[model samples]
Target: MRCARSLVRIQSLRALTAAAGGTVQPAATRKAPHARSLIAHEPCGQALRSLHTACVLLKNRPVATDYQEKSEREGEAAKSLVTYDDLFERAALEAKTKATFNQVLDVFIKRDIRRRGHVEFIYAALRKMPEFGVERDLEVYNKLLDVFPKEIFVPRNYIQRMFNHYPRQQECGVQVLEQMENYGIMPNVQTKVLLVQIFGEKSHPVRKYQRLLYWFPRFKHANPFPVPHQLPQDPVDLARFSLSRIANDLDARVTVYQLPYTDVCETGEEVTQPYVVGIQSPDQRHLLAKHNPSRPVFVEGPFPLWLRKTCVYYYVLRADPLPPEEKVEEPVDPERCFYYPLQLELDLERDLGDDDSFDVDEVDEGPVFAMCMAGRGDQATLAKWISGLQETNPILGRTATVFRLESGVRELQSAAEPEPEARPGEEEEELQSRGVKQ
Candidate 1:
């Protein structure tokens, strides 16, 4: 009875399998179909396919490190392969604007090329600017000027370099200036100053002076006031004064005039020495006449005929008044006070001769007061003179001040005191207004 029951159960199982339209299979074999059905029904199959596709794509794609290495190799090859001529041709073809041209020139400049060659390349590029459809402007020329190396050399070494680089290097700046003029681009004050600095660096004293004088008028015209609050004076006069000061500092022979004394004529005293030749300012004449009526005032010098021509070249430029303590009484005209300072200009060249030795008594003959103007070259000399005076005459030294011609009387008066400390927050406010972060 048990065997028959078991057999009947097996037949029932087979019948169920047939009804499901499949044959009976092992559990492991059946599991795959079951899982596939579950995945298909739950939308996980689509996700799995997408993941597989992404993996394949990622495996085939270029690696960043490999890409960068390849790019670097290509760049190195390109640098070695391309010539400046090729660059020029390429620029000519595609550099169609001023900015583009500038970019091309910048590239040329950055390349490892000889300085002269670089300059030549720039000139060539500029010549073809119109062909490249680039418009030239003042800024372009200025940029070119800026590209010229402005390496400063010590004065002695500069002389040597100038000797070595003569003609070619010297002509470079001049050529640039000429080119700018040709383009009808007027150089501004900054440009003039730059040129002046360049000339000063490259040339000797005589050449430098000549170049300065040549450009000074133009410089003055462009910049009417080099220092603020100073009135515009005659450019010629300023140039002469500057040159004379330069010559004096160099210990070159400078002619200085002495005011004529009437005692020699009135008392019938023999005139042992002739008066030093100088051009007296109208103010000087007015002062002499008012203060010393008995004094013989000579308009021109009584001098040897040969000395007269050379003496006129050098003149007493101006005199600055000593402090009140030095003068017994204030001048009737305060303006004329500068004309008579109880000082004398001894010709160091005459006294020292070729020996260049100075006598202590000769140097200390009278109180030495140095005249300095702001923005002028004589400040250093003035400082030296002041220091010397401090040792020689303590009283006069205390009264001496740096004569800042650009400063007003009030400014000068205030300059004697210590500068006021800034108020709280004022400094920060000023910096902020100037677009600086404190």
Candidate 2:
């Protein structure tokens, strides 16, 4: 064994610098390895006989120690095990792979997270995956609770699943809600509604929380906060973690404008509703302006239900919550006012057929008053705008009421504005080229 080891070392050294020829020369004049040296050499005459035996071994039986070019070629993969579409498809279908899915969800969102139809597709893909993911049991429960909405994929039992896995989810009643603190997902009143219900509390919205003489029997007795008749004019922007799931739950609407004034301009990072630049994400802007079919401006009954591509929803809240079918305002019968009879034809005009030319002949037109029309979805708002105008002077009141039709610049577009118009000959070509979609 000693001789075999020494012979192997010597052969290795020879292979290292084989061009140096058959001389047993020292490499770089280094000291001979005194601790270990080649023990014995075979007689030179028998070298030829030993070579034939070694060649046979090399040809017939390959050894692990032997480096064959064929083996390197054979063991490599024909192709990669995973692909981009495979990753995307898996992410769409698997819940347990969310950690892995996160690695690729960005791509899907960028490409396909558009209109409600696209959103529905994305959700379907995500739902098809396993509900449970690869995480510690507690972490899995926390993720299910904190990251997801109320049982979107399965019927309402996500909380139940958490309770089943970690009974502490039953005891504490929220693994996700608890983890939310670390991520700063502050619970809103709406979130609280769900949380309380999931913990087996009742579900009822309070119209006048302060006016309630008795405390809510279902809730834990705590210092109650004031609930406003309407949401604040400006609320926190929670675009990052909000859900389109409960978009219809509250009567909330967001209107954005490009005002020249910088003072009223909001410029801070807030986790809230529709963004205003340095404020929240910009993805919602295009969706509201483009896809929403409702009247673009705020007006009077059904305002707009605007759901943008980015999943930000801004709908109108009618002040009067009356049901849609009823008439908004009843008009007073003129006969009841003061025997208001029609004026005689002779008294109506000095010139019949309104004369050849008409000029301002000292017509006693009343003073003009300004009125604001908002949420113009129904006739009630129009009535309000007309009725809301207070006399500039309190003394004038109803006596000087004169009706005038004041219309805003309802026409005119800037020359630079680009209209989605068809070109001279492109109309037929365009229709013919509306190719089949995937």
Candidate 3:
């Protein structure tokens, strides 16, 4: 009992000392441990027992911890920031393929800006679309491209474009080419190929046909079948139409190669043979505008050399088309889609100087025109004869003269030179009469 009482008194003294700081004084000042304070922590409920033990350990002393300082330091590191520009540039690179980046940018614009950015956004004065939806939405499509500039793709992008764009370029990806450059994004080869296909003279598909590819892997999945309205009902009628147009060309133009000749041997007597020449004016509008398309008036032959010299040949604009003969060669049906107007057929040599839209037909020769040898020609020579006629008539090459580069240069040079100054004839006469001049 004395030892217990002594131990209690000693612990009380130590607790008071610890409360001041935590170090114990020398052993000489403390007493032995008491049996009551020597008990072990309970194993069954150690957590609860440890709490009690802790309270006992602290009962006579002060409590302290470092958790608050650790947490404060961690929070300062967690506040580190990520810039919107870095995110935006990455988004711009991938933005075209997916609109997610654009959405992010819209969010960033709301926050703050650092320096320079896409020029188009500046021009259009647009901040963003779906102002708050950037973090949630993600759907990229051709129609979604409406948010961007058209100049991006139209003529600048290297993407292989469709030929149909000639009619509707706005939707054809022309806008993409322009946008790529305008946004300062570099386009790939595919983008450039597309621009060429849409804006170049021949479409990429047409050129690509030689390799037997109708579609590209990029757009091969797109359905290319003709729309209902564009399909033709009769391919043979289409073929027949080619025959008449071909004949019209043969009669109006001159060619070097014998045009394919069609012949009917029925009646054996040969019914259509007349060697006459024409006197018609050529259409100046047929020539390209880049050239001096307005040509001087010319008269077509049989300006009867004899008739022209004697001022007896009648000059008219275009001979009336003749009846389709069985001897005309037919044209291929598939080539019709590529057909463009024949600008070479407008011949100044054959064109009337005066507009003869008012010419009244006086001859009853059933639409007067120059015709030569319609019946019973040698079959072997038919091709050669027809070929020669192609260049001479308005039906084929039509133009009396082919536009030559040298001829154009000469014409331009002559125009560039100043006209000769008019001589002062009256002044010379007056000077001679004056006699005061030595």
lDDT of 1 by residue, 61-118 (tens): 7789788999998886555434545666776676567767777668866765444354
Better of 2 and 3 by TM-score: 2
Cα displacement (Å) at residue 241, model 3: 41
Report the alpha-carbon TM-score of model 2 versus the true structure: 0.20
Give the per-residue lDDT digits (tens) of candidate 3, residues 265-361. Answer: 7777543332222211132113211122123212222222121112112122222233456134555555455666423345565456667579686
Error of 1 at 41 (Å): 98
Highest TM-score, which number? 1
> Could you tell me which 10 consecutive residues in candidate 1 have the lowest summed lDDT?
296-305
Per-residue lDDT of candidate 2, residues 30-65 (tens digit): 313431322324333223222322333344464663
lDDT of model number 1: 0.43
RMSD of each: 27.6, 26.2, 26.5
Name model 1 segments beyond 4 Å from true. 1-85, 113-116, 132-136, 152-166, 189-438
Quantify all predictions' global Cα lDDT against the true fold: 0.43, 0.33, 0.34
TM-score per prediction, in order, is: 0.26, 0.20, 0.17
What's the lDDT for candidate 2? Answer: 0.33
lDDT of 1 at 166: 43
